[model samples]
Target: MDRDSTLRVEKTTSLKAVVKKTYVLDTNVLLHDPTAVAAFKQHHVVIPMTVLEELDHIKDRRDKTVSREARIAIQMIDKVVDNASPQDIQAGVPVPGSTPEDVPRGTLAIYPDQRLIGDADVPYLDGTQDQANDNRIINVALSLQAENPAEFVCLVTKDINMRIKAKGSGLIHVEDYRRDRVLDDIDLLARGYEHVEGDFWSMISEVDTLREGNCTLHRIPRKSLPQAYPNMFVHDDQEFIAFVQRVDRDFVYLRCDSRDSLMHKRFWGLSPRNLEQAMAMSLLDNDSVDMTVMTGPAGSGKTLLALAYGLHAILEQNKYSKLIVARSTPPIAEDIGFLPGTEEEKMAPWLAAFDDNLEVLHGTDESCHGSITYVKERANIQFKSLNFMRGRSFNNAYIVIDEAQGLTQFQLKSVISRVGADSKIVVLGNLAQIDNKYISPLTSGLTYLVEKSKAYPHAGIMHVNGIVRSRLAAFAEENL
Candidate 1:
């Protein structure tokens, strides 16, 4: 933000208009927020023809969310193209009320009185059609800036590097606020808390006894605290213990109990395949622990194990009241609509992952005495989409987040805050199979949990390495 930019914003009547003042929307931006064009209102919004070309390329993806966004964009383009007239043609449409509904939506006419800009002259301006998707969007902004040298041509994108490129291209660039900006440190900290105790090593070795209640132990080494501290306690009083635990080796093992093991099998479908599962189960089984994160590869069984545990806690143990599960349906830069149904119907495809896990728990035996009905009757399970999760709190429940690799840190934080008292959250995702390019394994929500949740006794992190799904799936995960 520069002085001129600051003054310009101050002078602008509305933030939306200020944001859209001579704006060039990148294709990713459109995919990230399908309503972006609508939100910009009367301002000139440019959608490079190449962007439409790219949307056409991804219109047939197997993933529902990606395919839906691409399809919706095509429809929107058609609406604009249909409304534009040869005489008073503004790009495609004049943008609703700004011009007229009959004028079509999303048409751009830089100068109504000047010679009309032809379609053939579109691609040859600032950005070359051969450039990358992000680069081409930037080029469009630059070309627009070149045409309207007096007006500020702002390029909106979720891509950080693209914004930097726009600046280099001598065009103003900004991140799309609708989908940009992850959770802040303060907000993220609200999901869990950390406390350290006097000693580390000795206490970790006595985790089983410590979780049992009525036990007094002294801290031995600052390093052994995280392993020794019971996974249930997350408060200022536990900081000493966690800090001491951090002093030891980077990783520590958690002790698992029968309750934890049962829950793991019930929610996720399988049991402890490696040391990580043992530790995760230990933390999850403990009443004091409020949140636990499990990260691994595709066949590592993170989602299955977490779901199994959640199911066990709710059904067999009569612990939580319900099982609420969530996951991001990619591409991360896409809308939730275009699935051709309501919200629940839209999420059906993504929820299939959890449904398959539940099916595994139900077993293959058809004559198993109404096993499907038995499980449904025993446990009140609900699958929810992230879009509709806002402004809701879940109390005394088991929450599972699958495919967490696609969530931004902000989204993870939002989900965690929804956990009420006596509720536990299980976040599991395979970082290796991440489909969102804006985020990687190390920077994803799952990774953020593993890194930040370490200081909280009530929060634990586990990384699964061994593959147990199937030989083919395991081989693909390992070799591919």
Candidate 2:
């Protein structure tokens, strides 16, 4: 071709090669997900120096989850810079992935506040006239946008107000880091059980019931099934309840016996007061299912059922060696300041629900007056903060995480990763009661685990309905 045509093609090629966008991250994004630096793939990720300062301030705090996350982000950036030359480190450095094969093609860049100090075109960010850290971060994004007009510039943060300010400041793009969100609507998530109208038992053709040890198994055609998994509960209008034993392409095998017999039977002196509670008890009683997620409102007995089962499993059945309880302590309105005590004592306030449930399970019998103490000692029950669960493994343990909705998906993964052989985990949470600003019902760790673990053979999920705590509690849950 002609020389001019070749030059034009080369110019177009270079523009296309440099067409990547720049994403400016806020401090909360790194605090939410420490590995966010590698999540941008082929784009450029910019971290304001103010974010580093924030991380430095939070790294030594008592809140282990946030503190650890800050340390991890700082270490990740340090490692990338340490491996590169001084010039490359200043300009940009490739973010290393969790695995060698997963190295991100993106570049990580640090933006200093000085770059935005004397810029005449940039204005102070929204909310205040002062030069706040958020304003400085937005200024860096504004500078990047002005410098690279050909590419898109966006700010990523978990803070809603900051997103609004960034958009108002004329930044084109803004978004929450939703890589861990497993569901769009928390209400539409699965409950791991299906209720059949009319008579479900008569619909089964060529049903064969056989006794297998302590369980009764029923075989039915696969085409007659409603979506189900092993250990999932199936109930009908006839008050007939059954558990799925195994599902094959040709037929579905169900254990026709009522595993809810445990619900009728006493568990640590507490009995299931409702159908949902019975379903939860059945799931916890079954030896085949190792992981279960339970969600309900405040007075629905989520924690009570879980703790009773944990006690029964560890103390009565000897199925597990110990009972481990953990939970996330996300604050409601404002910070409560530093709690003064040992780790377990510090976690006591968050675990008050456990104490209340244990009291109910122990009942008012004078002989069982020290039931809480007896159970805690005899069952080897241990209370732990979710913050320090990383890199530890639990074997032969019944682990129950209470108030799980406050946790992010990353925190849940950290807790779940610690489960070892001969261990079962029960995650209890009320999605409607989430207090963590960074997590919503749709993005909660409980919802994520319930959605992702649905199809697994060894996992089960149940969403408890109705409140059985008391008439007063039920009335308040409905009206106020």
Candidate number with greatest lDDT: 2
Candidate 2 — what's its lDDT?
A: 0.81
Clashing pairs in 2: none
State the lDDT of candidate 1 residue by residue for 211-261, as single tens digits.
324433333333543333334222232222121122234433333223334
After superposing candidate 2 on the true structure, give the runs of residues whose Cα lies further than 4 Å from its correct spot.
1-19, 96-104, 123-130, 199-227, 246-253, 257-263, 329-346
lDDT of each: 0.60, 0.81
Please state the error at residue 305 of candidate 2 in Å. Answer: 1.2
Candidate 1 whole-model C-alpha lDDT, 0 to 1: 0.60
Candidate 2 on 1-480: residue-level lDDT in tens? 788876774334444454667889999989888888888877788888889999999999867788888999899788767778756765778776623565447888887655455555765454133656887888788878877877899889888988898889888888888877777777678887888999987887678777879877888888888576677778898878777887877877887646457458667767877777888887888788999898888899888888888887777788999999997665433223466767777778778888888878767858555867888899988888776778899999999988888887788888898999999999988888887888888778778888888878888889898988789998988899
Per TM-score, the best of the predicted structures is 2
